[model samples]
Target: MHTTLLKDFSVSAAIAGFVTVLVGFTSSAVIVFQAAQAFDASPAEIGSWMGALGLGMGLTCIVLSLRYRVPVVTAWSTPGAAMLITTATGVPMEEAIGAFLISAVLITLCGFSGWFERAINRIPMSIAAGMLAGVLLRFGLDVFISMQTQFVMTFSMFCIYLIMRRFSPRYAVVTALILGILIAGSQGLLQIDTVRLQLAEPVLTTPRFSLSALIGVALPLFVVTMASQNVPGVAVIRASGYTVPISPLIGWTGATTLVLAPFGAFALNLAAITAAICMGREAHEDPARRYVAAIAAGVFYLIIGLFGGTVGSIFAAFPQELVLAIAGLALLGTIGNGLLTALIQEKEREPALITFLVTASGITLFSIGSAFWGLVAGGLAIAISQVKR
Candidate 1:
């Protein structure tokens, strides 16, 4: 019955899932890896994170999609990963875990009380879109700049993506990945020696909850994860043409974070750019059938969890230019749409544009990343406009 509207459940869903995780993992898993390095995490602890992240994101997507019967794809919060990389560095692993616990508690409260959902709903969609666009602009720059070093391999795959997107847009990423691999292989850019399959060991870090850690780590983490990660994450979902319970998602991610905190899972929330890939029409033409793709993504995430070491190694083997090209290429559509949406409404246009520019400017104040500041600038713009109007 559902097939009539959606068609090819397992196959399409599997492809969608593969693309989602492949793209998602390739993009920011490194940040998480780096965070682990900062805290001197053991390989097993890192693997545990992969496992927990896989389980948390996979279970959430499966349940949410099944319950809502919408393609409610959940992602391991990208903003949180960025926050950890920037803010959690040098802090003891235990304190990081403590911060995670605190953030999770706060997150659970938000979900249960529904305060977060209400606040998020208040943000104008255009501003949200603008912020997303601003965040992606840096990535777009990397893609082009990479061409100077890896002109042949990166540009070749990029051209393939462009051509494929013009035709079989759904398979654009798959095609790019395959072609990039082949090109990289031909150029000896693929480093197979680094691929090592080892069981990931889980390291238990004792939580040392402290006021300083809470102020320095937890608050910033919660703020960025909620404002930058969850906010844009849900925006990606709604913008991609689906609706789900945001509060419950926050609750679920918080629950997962609480469960995995000891194992080095710092934070988990919905993903924005990565989620966009899975939720977009390119994932599947029929929005109704897209859950299959999300389920597929969950499965891929499970693979990531299972062979966290090997998978991370293999992805790490790829040329940075190759990853940069593919990521930038994949996000082009979402970026274009975000810019357009931000500037659409006349009253919101100036503020939205200002928000976009400020975000794209890559200004970092007080060691805080661009995501939080973009929201601040954008929100301030919106507030000023409302006062005048």
Candidate 2:
């Protein structure tokens, strides 16, 4: 498998892996920290969570991709982390861990029972694509919105991306990352001092279950992860024309999460936008060989896990504008693909558009995210249209 990855290796695939981790950690590591803080986790406990998550993601990405020979990248549930930022407060650390365990168990059951996979498969391709696009729309727009503050750096990165896209589309994101870093460095935007060299040790917290925490934290986390993260992840895989079984993957993630919950593995699931970096044509000319990109990402993830504290600092040192710019540039192709796919079926177009717009609105009601509502809205639209017909 190592030999296969080496033999099929391309610079594009390597860059894609680096870009995937860069975007993944940069965009959401802070949210994960906030989630940990909400549960009143000590510094050591919080660091442990980062380490556990990185290790889980690393192992899963490598194992799944190598075993299946597909680009089966996994990620810490970013949206789940975001949901935790708001919902975790007032929940005791022990109870939070209990909630995590419950959520993981539920996810595992859903995967093993095939209910989650079946329900996900029932979503039309247009609606799935619309949901994905809606989820990513903010990051895409942030590329431009960032220009207002860091005009020179963002503009330079954008120009470099354009130039690279024209000449070597596969490495455009790589070029943008490099240019963003260089520009940020030149402008003294990085906090190099904060990034100390160190390894992170995991701190386990005992779990204490509560019905309130189960319903408030566990159920909501489960729903947010499924609707906001896993759904888009499956959509990305299907859109990329991969035949990987979603149920087993989800089950494995849930199982992994369950084991590591005491150490802060909140949720681990398939990646959507970041996985696209590995699955894209740029990663490898032969779709079958693109698993190498995922493996590469796993390698980086392992490094991040082993040195969790340092890795967190490194990603933190990157300027917000730089991170946003690179993330947006990397996701441009994905966003375009999603929009194109969502609009392909004439009959489904309206509902899909509604889904897209609602998701893009970033609405939150009853502490549930817009992705769930968008799906509901689109499903309702489809049912109403069918009744009218």
Candidate 3:
């Protein structure tokens, strides 16, 4: 078993895993910290939040990927954290913990009941592909956008990426990342001094459930996590052509969240963006071997959980443009495939295009994200078109 695993490992896959963790943490860790602060959590408790989240994501990503031989990545629910920033303010920390528990229980019920998986399975592939393309369109654009400010670094990475793609496609993203890091380091853009090696300790908060907390915090957290995070997550998996069982994946994440909530794991769900990083061709030329990338990501997540402060600081030390450049470059292939699949079927083309546009528009209504709204719009379009037919 160990030899088989070693044979599957590749430098590109490991780099893909590192890039996934880097993007996931740098993009949203601050929001999670603020969510903890909103509930009047202490610094230690906030670190506990990071620790719990990291452990949950790490374990789920590793276990699920290995079990299914699919690149099943998991993450702290960024949308849930963002919602908590507003809704958790003035709520007692214990009550917030209670709400997290309630939300996790609800998610577990949905997953174990197989309802969420059934519903997601009904979403047409073209629509799912469109939503995914829309979801990732921004990241692809950012590769060039970064050049406006950090031309020397971003443009250098872009050129190197193109060159690598022409010669050694598997190493394009890795080359871009290495070149970006070197350029950032040479420019003194890497803030190495800010990184300190501090181990994270979990601080538990006892649950204090209330009807108001259930209505205000728990329900919204569950809704946002499902609609904004998990739905697109499932879409990404399907769009990438993986057929891993969805119910168990969702059930395990919810179960993990339930176990860790008292220690500040507010919500854990399937990761769309980060998962794409591990599922894309850049992770491995052979799709079957991509699971190793997720396993590598799990190891990184474990490191973050054990040394939450230090890992957080290390990700923070990276220059913003470098992160943006590498992420955008890495995702270029996935975005293109998503767009192509979305428009391939003539009957679904218009609806899929609408879904893509609506999602890329980035509009939010009633606190729900564009991904959900895009699905609704595409579904409605499909319905109307069928009626006409």
Candidate 4:
């Protein structure tokens, strides 16, 4: 893997990126769509986002891996997309676009200046592990919690997944997704009418730069996305024992986001949970070959951009429970490992567990997501415990 990327390409590497693409796009594409809805994005605007994000992620990953000679991957800003649901609302789309650009600039600054790396150095390994666990735990719980209302639909899918995992673990997630769709359609749990088959045409919105949008949406978003998401995202790569260039990777993602902001690309950041899966041994035994997986992901993302509405509709077709169950199963290993890592140390264990539990509890305070507060509370716990000593 370290020697050179092209040198590592194998038949196995070729499919790694494709598998990554399906996992990423299928897993949380709907949530991203819902987030766009909160910002009052039209279908075209949403598709543009999907398109630009695909283009940015694809171009960057493909370029950087070949250029840098590493299995480097760039992901659309998942946390930033997550933020739009609650924070990007009421702001004009143009201002949000401006925010996207501004945030990209900041991200670039972080990379060029090496400030992010410097700051990351200060974080205790245990705390970083805890935060990673905490962040992923939210999605982990969402997987099952979603089933509370849709049990029959979810349970059947779970059973199919179990059977597949026993027989063919490699295709378990994909098979489960397929079975979920079939069962959902049969049960009448799938909703197909809302799907618009038209190709997504990019609507150019003249960006309206506002200090207010920068102050409200852009700054906090850049902070949370970088600190909460990218920080852990990078950690996942390092933790998985991959040593790639951090600064260049950040710069590439930031630059890509800057280019696509005109088309409503909100944020582009490294993926933590999902990227780890692709980078880890599970994706391929040979580390040198994982770039192929990222390439596959890029190709799939391009396809998503081409048929944004149709692809979006297909994901929406399955009963919601099926998606939830699949996500839970796919992420279960990462979640459990993260929690175990977070609590392994004696001093940090309690605080880390508090972080995980509070984050998992889904208690939102003062309009802020629990992901942030979990960090705050855990940090406070660590601080106070330190002071007592």
> Candidate 3 clashing pairs?
none
Residue-by-residue lDDT tens digits, candidate 2, 1-389: 66776888888788888878988998788889888898888888887998999899999999999889999999999878988888876889999999999999998998878888998888887887888888788888999999999999999999988998898887777778888888899889999989888788988899999999998899989988887778778987887778878899999999999999999999999898799878876676689988989989998999988888689888888898988887777777778988999999999999999999998898987666777788888888988988953
TM-score: model 4 vs. ground truth: 0.79
Model 1 clash count equals: 5
Q: Is candidate 2 or candidate 4 better by TM-score?
A: 2
User: Which segments of model 1 are wrong by more than 4 Å?
Assistant: 1-16, 73-96, 204-212
Pick by lDDT: 1 or 3, better one: 3
Q: What is the lDDT of residue 263 in candidate 4?
A: 85
Candidate number of the best TM-score: 3
| TM-score against native, each model | 0.87, 0.93, 0.99, 0.79
Candidate 3, superposed: residue stretches over 4 Å from native: none
lDDT of 4 by residue, 215-244 (tens): 888887788668656776776666555667
lDDT for each residue of candidate 1 in 324-367, tens digit (9 for 90 to 100):
77767767777887888889899899878877887788777655
Worst 10 residues of 4 by lDDT: 10-19
For residue 292, give model 1's deviation from the true position in Å.
3.2
Candidate 3: 10-residue stretch with minimal lDDT: 380-389
TM-score computed on alpha carbons, candidate 3: 0.99
Worst 10 residues of 1 by lDDT: 4-13
lDDT assessment of candidate 3: 0.94
| C-alpha lDDT score of every prediction, in listed order | 0.75, 0.87, 0.94, 0.70
